[model samples]
Target: MSLNKAVMLLKIIFILTAATSIQGKVYHPSYIDEASTFASSSEYDYIVIGGGTAGCPLAATLSQKYKVLLLERGGSPYGNPNVTQMQNFHISLMDTSPDSPSQPFVSTDGVINARARVLGGGTCINAGFYSRASPSFVKSVGWQEDFVNDSYRWIERQIVHCPNLAPWQAAVRDGLLMAGVSPFNGYTYDHVYGTKVGGTIFDKSGYRSTAADLLSAANHTNLRVLLRATVLKIRFDQSGSRPKAVGVLFKDENGNHHLASLNVGEGKSQVIISAGAIGSPQLLMLSGIGPKSHLKAKKVPVVLHNKFVGKGMADNPLNSIFIPTKKQVKQSLIQIVGITKYGSYIEASSGFSQSSKSISYHHGIMSAEAGQLATIPPKERSFEAISSYIEKKVKKKIPIEAFRGGFILSKIAGPNSKGHLKLIDTNIDNNPEVTFNYFSDPFDLHRCVKGIETIAKMVHTSHLLNLTNDDDYSMKMLLNISVDANINFIPKHFNDTSSLEQFCKDTVITIWHYHGGCQVGKVVDSDYKLLGVDGAMVVDGSTFLKSPGTNPQATVLMMGRYVGVKILRERLGSEAGV
Candidate 1:
């Protein structure tokens, strides 16, 4: 048979196989139900809100022995091509519809960002890089080291996959080594200081397996997952000396309200908010657990005055160099990462195709200016403003071909610069205003400068230089060494410290590794229990003081399982009168 016919036959077989597999995997989880079908009220041993990265695994682990109800504001990711297909990464973010899994929001700091609005949370929409928390990070968080390791292994076994490095990725890996980032760690899920190929949630077939897939480990009979259930407020019993979270008031997709309550007689029954960094803190504030003055200003009845609910928000600042090569690079997402001692991470992705709509709306460095104008929905923009903005940006439109190349990006590790989240209103659907205050701290700024300098060194390295044609303008653009470099692009020289610093500030973008709104010790205890309330806790990225490892997803997934086991052990001991 001809090669073309053979390839076509393979594609057909793969699609058929994938269709059958998906039917068994996502469609019939059996425990999931739409919130529209939910009764007016129900009781459970545990009520977990937000079925994203952390929530799904937490709920699944809890359901192993206790009755658990998991509430997610978004729909299942089952048939979403933009989410499941690795090639359609940017397509998911381009969708600005109300029901889009990737929810776009601009920070007050003027950086564009996105938050997960789907069942699997950020995992459903992210680049899928997976790495465990550094040992030091684990120790600082006060988790038992052995338990943390075990939890990571549990998650790795379930959802993580070792990615085969594409040509561009392999070249980037060698480039990182040549740049003096040293001690090549080969392929590892462990967070080590060096260049390494990390695990990904996308498998060999380029299909994603999200935290929602972790539900396969759950006791389905004991778990009830409700989709399109936006929890409006935490229902607290104030009759006691201290407020206790008893239930939650939530609305379904159809706007009908329902209450899911914790079992009254079960003293250990609790409500866990795993609603991510932004959502968790916002939920807490809306539920009247934030700053007393802020809650009052929003007309929310205060249950407790924590003073700190939406503070310490931090997002690692990312600066990238887009390298358009003479030779077509294979399409890839994050596979190789350079973990440096200079408090920076170097990562790369190559060859992504974005729709024109996405390019217009993308908040990345390429069209960030246009993105600012596009932030407002089309209906909200005046026709004149829309036309004028489009004329300027779209008229000089970047050809889709320019995007066929890859990005070599750098993000500062555990950025010391922090900001806060504030309520614009009490509605959970509306995103709370957040400011990351990127590079406000001199330490963070210094780290960024060093990181960018490192990138310059990498591009000049033999590995990357060998890949670039000598006459190629893209290589010269790396450091703007050649007069032939693209004149439209602003190039930063390695030795020019001022230029690098300015470049860092001017082109700053979010890697979407933001964390710490409802921070540890401030809003919740080490055990993740809410400081001011009984039978309540926040168990998500919001509790993190820093982003763990190279990416937070793997650690977040591990956290769910870790915390669930902890809670289960405590409950079991309590039942046995220990």
Candidate 2:
């Protein structure tokens, strides 16, 4: 470890020691392995499902004053090199194991999306670029701005850190400005439009402190975390007039069944589902709390007929430009972002060229369009939409010894299209059917096309001229996209918007920012309480009304903190509107 990380670790230890009575041990232990260390049959003040990005902090905060049980479907990240190392960020996604941190799946729409199955969730595997939620997002969701800001503070101090920008990332910063994304705002985590160096989860030593680290401030005496514990369903007690969530039934790593129940009371006991947008909605439907007709079709008993359980699904789609350099450049993930006004954001990452074997074909969350025509109607499909399909696809890995250059990614910051998640079968082992009608809205397609043109312009900027041009900016490197586009073609000019649409159709994929399958104001209230259910709540990205204008990690963290406090406040009769 570097001196910077050593000091930070030591400082954390110091705080834990100094405040031991106030806070308990925050360590990742396999509750299933050590049965004596955990309870077999017990009651918790709260049962928190899915120890992920949202679940970790939410359970940690709740454990301060109440007994909380947090269950994770995958193993711990404590000893996983692929999860704790910054450069190995992509390695976990390449994992095909059933319990991989990122569980890969193909959507009904033929989009390749992965759901987080491990502790700390996507923060354990995603590009570490971090930023605050847009102020508009906080307002639209009716979140207390002060509480949200404070919640971010609790996370930033633990896992969030400033990145040491390398030469390639610096070039990306300058290039974005040269492309007219002006007024560099220096290094800050505030959400704003224009060029800015945001926060990162990777420390200066390249070690990542995941959201699990936030548990250090949790009351371990009141908290219990079970890894390899798959929650099959939310057990409901409909003995009263309204159905109440009483507990959850989960299986341990040994395939032994266990039931975790809430303390006996009317509204005294609670269940909070933080299993993410996909898992949360799927679990709801399986528990018979979704649409009546859909649940009945799947042979699930009707509990409450919530018509909008799995209706709106939004994913931020991106188009990438891979420019291979002759010389080796510095390596890093996301460091700088160019937030523009054209309903798009241009962010760049370095450091991938060093890891040659990891960039697999699965990187394309949405494959080429020809294979996708099956998802749509035959009348809606056309021959022109099939360019660069399976035939023109690039190789899984680049063979060049020193393949180093820039990777400029253009993402539609705000998308108009929405999809849904439905049950394929009644078995909990079976995955839910996900359909992302990505470009279903022509306006969304138009926005992504505009983003593509913006990225092309950024590539040709004077700041990045050194990439394609030699000294004196005359001769240039080969614009050979034979592998990427499958044709020997050079850009006629930087502002070429004609092939822009084709490029997006061919290479665009999801950035893996999925939200709104169980949206707020539609399915749940602003406070995140299930509309027709009592004693159950959701505090994950599934509650997002729309995708925020930036990466959703910080926003998700804020929601966890906000809802955690809200639950605690209501329990105490303070009723603070956080």
Candidate 3:
């Protein structure tokens, strides 16, 4: 070979090697757990305290210009089929293992819901429904519209899928409109009132695309992702009137403590808390940056006394009704939603019945519903999970039908109701005292009652209800059916409106969309910086000021994309890397 030809081949080899090395920067939690590998004293330009729905994308975007460390308290979602498959959506929630993606926790109000613990956070286990923030919601949160639009496009290209609705989902779309949700808006990424089909995170093949996919956009040379690295606390500098978050102390898989600090630099060096609704405020208060008196009660030394950290915690409480049909309805999650003239919102899914496994963990009103569904008085109604095997072996041969067929849920999108988190123990591993205080305000209960009535009316008008038999049918009869729970006041029918109020109390479930701990207006400034802390910021669902009036995953992703670009824009001229 000629010397010049050999030299050219060597140059190509060197270029390829360099590119591969750059993309291999992310590490497992144990890599940093070792004292020698990652000394207790380490630093970075940005330390993101959660590898969740928001944290992953935000870190990816930020890494384009500067160094970023993303620490997650759970395992990676890459190989976990329970998390990666849309079919295992319910199974993931029912998983009882310590490292299960969905960590079940009971709120003080007796609400039974799980917290997301996998690297992609809630997106790993949530129903995979996707819808953009309402224009009003975007405006209320004080976002720049053009940036919001671009950000949505950027993130959507990575994870959002325009789904082809199943037979059941299509029926739901028509039912929503028939129920007075009004003028069908057709397929849209835009969120608004009235019946409309929206985008989803689940693709046509039933494979889920999560925020973890967005990590592909990261400048791998500058980004480091560590899993099972639980952040214990955010350490702060208290020399000034307000505290400044300088570093985070985290525990690795081995329970060894490590600290990540801001590198010696300018204003951009900071710690960010995107630990989610329950976790963000919990960590802030653990770091001594919450309501002064509440911190004092928890025996945590007050660092900043920002009263709003854990205040105004709100969840879109789901009022659920399980409809039994003679024909099997295809299994699915939220695909189409109904927006009422009132503030309430309605959505439906098929094959999404609360599991017998989860029923074992029931508390409060959930226990009542679980009890009613349990202790089967002979197996009358039944539904088999549909799969290719079932289709080929059973369904194609015998025509087996599904019994536990329909799922209907109503939510008060803009709830007047609110709750707060209380510290149960100073130990960071212990779950905080979560209280929904649902129905504490009667007006809130009134809205829910009205929503229930509207759903009942909608069910009657829905073509979906045609599957019911003449013997046991009608929305009133469905409401009257209950698990053999010995609760008093068995409703004979819905004729007496009085029974409806009691019914609402009996079957409420969380759609699991928890928002507001470090809220936008009250806890963080318009820029998403902590109100009383410097060198820190929060970018997650907790930052939402109002409910999206629909499933909130899309809005949360939009926030992640929006905040990431905003940080870059803020340091446009000043930062060295940018």
Candidate 4:
């Protein structure tokens, strides 16, 4: 070989070695020192507590211009194989209960539903079902026209919500449509905001993309996300006339106390709380920002005394009506579509096949004939009323055929329920008591009962009858229509004659759509700035003024973006002297 060629080969080898070393230096969970602790006085430009739905996006966006610190109560999900895989979402559900201390996820009073506790927050463990809030509901929250319009466009660009065409979702969709459950085809983009015709599924990529995706892209050295760092209390500056949120006092998994504060002016710092509905309110109460009466009971010194801090607690009550299928579904049809279309795009990096195969069936019942129920006084609403309403709705909706063939009825408890989150104990680690008082409002119960009856009619319709009949030889017979077939079948399961008033009493659980505790117009202003506090802001589901009549993820994300933009504009304007 020529001498020149040999010299060139050595130089190429050196360059390759250098690149490999740099790549290996990338930060991973294992590299973070678990034992290494941060000081109580250590400060940053922005301290975002609770790295869930709102926190992640807020941190990701603000980090672009400021030095941000994200604090989460849960541990790092990075190396955990269960969090990374898509199918593991269901598996992680079992680990998400409030009682499951080992897991970071919590439920109301320690019960588990669908919330997550990892780095990406709930998006990491949620079913990845993306739906926008109804525009009507958005307007009710005092969002101006321009803000709403820009939010819609910004969210679309940030998180991609293509349809889920997976085989599993496809099968579910086909089964639903074939059975007369029509697809909601109207106004797909803003369907979640107000009225929805058909259920929208999660986009493919196998897994739903979360704030982790965006955060990963930013990868700035000035920004840091500390997981398993639960905020115990908000430290206030005593020198201020009105207490200012100077820092956060948090505890690690090992139960060691640490504090993260702001270095304002010189560094210009602020604290954004996005710990979720339950977590955010609880944190405020612990820090002495809630009702004076409640804090007096807890014996915590009151700082702000906002009576509305945890007052307007609200959640959608969901009742499910299960209908047995005649044919054995081998796999969910939507899953197949998601796998093929979304999977293909992920692998080949081409085409419009961006949706996944998760199927959702949503049915809305709005009646001009039906008048809105009278609003129940907050003190008068009770659990009994809530349950009774659900039962009444189910009975009215049951079809004669459904009476013959068993069909499960799922109803969303109306938006009038009055509930609150109160501190059961002074311990920050202890879960707060969440009084859902689900069926408290008579009107809420009435609407739910009406909704059930509506669903029953749809189930008994011809479209459903044809799909459920045992025409296929391989399928099991769900309903028997032979002359000698038991007539009691109709009366037994779908007994319309009998009062289903007991149904709600039997089964009424929160739809997991808890909101309005630290409500807009009440606890915080429209901009999400706490009315009484200077440096504190509540930007999670708790800030929702009213229930959006659907899942709250999209709206929550929009709120995060809105808050981020507002903060940036204010800070940047000050800096630029505009």
Candidate 5:
């Protein structure tokens, strides 16, 4: 062959390789990009606001059919090694501060909770606990069978949810069980969710698993993830009565605003809000799609008067009782459990094997009187009621003095009290007023009291008692002594345990599980489409009508996948060629 011809062929091959690699490249925009460049561009079929949880998956799925653009207000998640490692994610929370680009939203009320402002969204900074929705929750929301079935299949295929227990997690679970705490079945069936006597733990696969998994799986061509890009507003076509979301207005790190209009047919464009409970509602309110009164008060014109935009906020209140362990367990036990349950994945990728050791146990009070549980008003349900209910249930389940070892009781679904996320000021950049109004409901207060009492009972149980040494047991004995004793034992360590109600109020902390605000039916339909808004939807936990009974990450992913399929099917038709 001629030398000239060979050179030409080589050049063609080189160009092809480069193009393919560029298509596969993951875009990680920083805070330094010139905003003017993004503002001038006018290309994209679908613009997904908030590149966290739901947005990431939506981008990957829609990209299969059309050009998709994902706008994240935060920076790239790749630089943080702690985010990649599972065990490190928890500790990484300590590093999250007001200054971090990965967390753009901050609680005005000082509370330490991590929200990932990175490309993967909250998934980049979560505990990596993969729990499915409770059956009762699914049925309550009226999710069609087809939708529910598709969600399960999509999750199993996209997100690996089998137990990834590390050795440390296993040891913890075993120790807890050996000390008489039973594991609840983790799976759910119908209105019944399964709980086991043993706690479930995930392996050492890194903490952040959202974009790393879905984007890797879909392998789409037209999808682009733009980090450090915050959407400032949604532009609507002014000519129409029911305004159409024609484009989105976004700002890069330089504070420059860019507008990208919808390019339909090339791909029908729509905005999917997966910016999490706080961000999604904030964005909606910023764009004039919130409570009319609040919007007007802030001098922002109202486009949609959705009173429920940020009203039904909910989160799990965790009250931990630290039980002193007899043995100094190495943290490596976390890795061991992961290898045991997900050995194949660990061996194949070396990702799961090195995963962290995070153990979570689930135990709750089941009302024996059935409908009697619903007697309290939903909004009026306080932590006290929740605590009382727990006590009643525990008294029925086991003897109050059955537990004697050192252990902690973590309670989810503490209260049913509602909270609101209102605009703090006219400035869209400022965070909203987030009041959990935690423990405001009577049921919530009762449940907390009961939860504490139940924990105390477990501490006195035989199994727990056997694990405690004589000295520790004697100390407990002294606290229980009567006033008739010659020397009154005012045990300093036991002062915190004097009363169940007091113990609950002092020890209970937010479990970092927030949801329900902008809930389904009230704000949006079951499919997550806004009740009155066209060309927009809320796809985060904000749309959850009622808080599910476990970690919500898996359920959130399922909702995203479910919504993605519905949108795709509607747009492309069931038989349309991909």
Candidate 6:
């Protein structure tokens, strides 16, 4: 190894060792408290709306000099096994309980997808893949390169790890190279073209470290985090020249209401909304800051009518093929990826353990999407309604065992097929109606086809077939003719161009990489502040025009720290009269 590479390896080892040393201990920060403990009203220099991936790090960084308050709608992830363990990954998404960490929503396009509801957001339930956004992406967004690099390092030091590739992942990596993906870039965190082993949030022992761990760096005396505190509205002071967001109305877990306001200080206090893509736009509309016609129709008093508030929504279209091996494959999540020039990404996961009960529940949830109960007008769901929905939708019991198979997934890169999000109900807890309009652009459809072809070539490579315990003939037969409950085989002999295009349309699913809605240069200014409002900003995936990297978790985490540092610099400059 070169001098720089050796030093880098040593640094990673030190950090990982320090992280492993604390695996067995529970260390809840002193700033954390239940929402019920809050008074009727409180004030802070910075009020962060969502305590998810971006919110935690933003709040932690701001607390270094100013008082900060972070409000989360769900319970903590500290004690949740489904969120903390890698093996139970699918269970969290399949869970349909009232307080489940993953909240399922069906789009108008007839796709069933889930979003994060817990304090740590998607990081708590994701496949834990981690990679930084490309330098070109940072430059496009006009962020300082040095600051972005520092922020990425800040996040990596806490939760990121170089994964020890399992046998299946190793074979896939070799196959990617053999199939002309080109230039093997060994292990890396950089988002470069070609096959490479990327960082994972799951450690060697399969324990997931989330963005919430960033809160350990917070100044407890300056920060206060309230769990189960759902913000209902952003209260504006119309007396000002521009309607200024001065406070927010929120409800506690016990159904009691409370208000959190910005403090009257010289530091330019503000309310920052770090809610996910769906939640941020929904909250903004609920606060009367959407299109005039839509708000009036919903009986919501209009505050600021920006036609683009909920426009420009987009979700990367994902297509996958299931490979069911005859022998047991070591279970793993996404630890390796193949970045292609054809505008698609290839990744694989093996041996995901899914319980029979959860599989049944998953089936019922998707089935319910086609029924009237899924589109019920009520914002609050009752237990009886849920029970009725399940009973009616689940006609037969599914006999799914712990799955021993793996999947080869291809995700479209920066999909040009844009969508929109709109309110279905007024309640903050309710899911909004969204339509991704997958493959609406011909370019996106072509990319999907190219991606599928790449995966087909990789599957046929000798590297993959040779490493498998099953004989080559059987594996080829399985590839040629096998259909699972979830995925259908898109055979290597699928030569017709029209057939491949239709297959792309018929089997498209979400990789949970959806972003946009309150996009930059539209609803928000370059600084992420809402265009027509003051004292408020939206700083999450909702503001992105394109998804960053192979996985967005790392960039999203870096964004929180990046924005915090900028705000601090501005405040310091103001204090010095620069």
Each candidate structure's TM-score, on Cα atoms with residue i matched to residue i, is 0.89, 0.85, 0.83, 0.71, 0.72, 0.87
Clashes of 1: 0
Q: Candidate 1 — what's its lDDT?
A: 0.80
Ranking by lDDT: 1, 6, 2, 3, 5, 4
Give me the displacement of residue 335 in model 5, in angstroms. Answer: 12
The per-model lDDT (C-alpha) reads 0.80, 0.71, 0.69, 0.53, 0.53, 0.78
How many Å off is the CA of 111 in candidate 4?
7.7
In model 5, the Cα lDDT at residue 436 comes to 69
Please give the distance, in angstroms, between residue 207's alpha carbon in candidate 2 and its true position after superposition: 0.8
Q: Lowest lDDT 10-mer window, candidate 6? A: 364-373
Best prediction by TM-score = 1
Clashing pairs in 1: none
Q: How do the residues 1-578 of candidate 5 rate in per-residue lDDT, one tens digit apiece?
A: 33234334434543453354335434443322323346446577778887767777777777777777778777655545445655334333433343343442333222224456767676776545555565666778776666766775675565554454433344344443443344333333212222231112233343345653566545356766665677888876656667667778887777777786677554346777788877778888888888899999988888878888888876655543433334322222112111111100000001122111111101111111111121233333343443354345422343222221222434545257677788888665567777666566766666655544444444555444444544366345434331222112121333354454444444444445777667778877777776776666778777875555355666677676677777788877975332
Clashes of 6: 0
Rank list by TM-score: 1, 6, 2, 3, 5, 4
Clash number for candidate 4 = 59
Q: Give the distance in Å from residue 350's predicted Cα in candidate 1 to where it truly belongs.
A: 0.7
Report the C-alpha lDDT of model 1 over 1-578, residue by residue, as the tens digit: 33234334434543553565455545636788999988755689999999999999899889888999999999899876668888767656645568788787778766767899989999999999998889999999999999888888888898889997898898889988988888899899888988999999999988899999998899899999999999999999999899999999999999998888899796989999999999999999999898999999999999999888999999988877766566657768899999999899999988644333343223132333322223333224332343354446443455433444567888999999999999999778998999898889999989988887787777767676666665445654433321232222334466888877766776677788999988888999999999978999999999998999999999999999999988888878655211
- RMSD of every prediction: 6.4, 8.2, 11.7, 14.0, 14.4, 9.1
Per residue, candidate 4 scores C-alpha lDDT tens digits across 455-482 of 4454555444454664431112323321
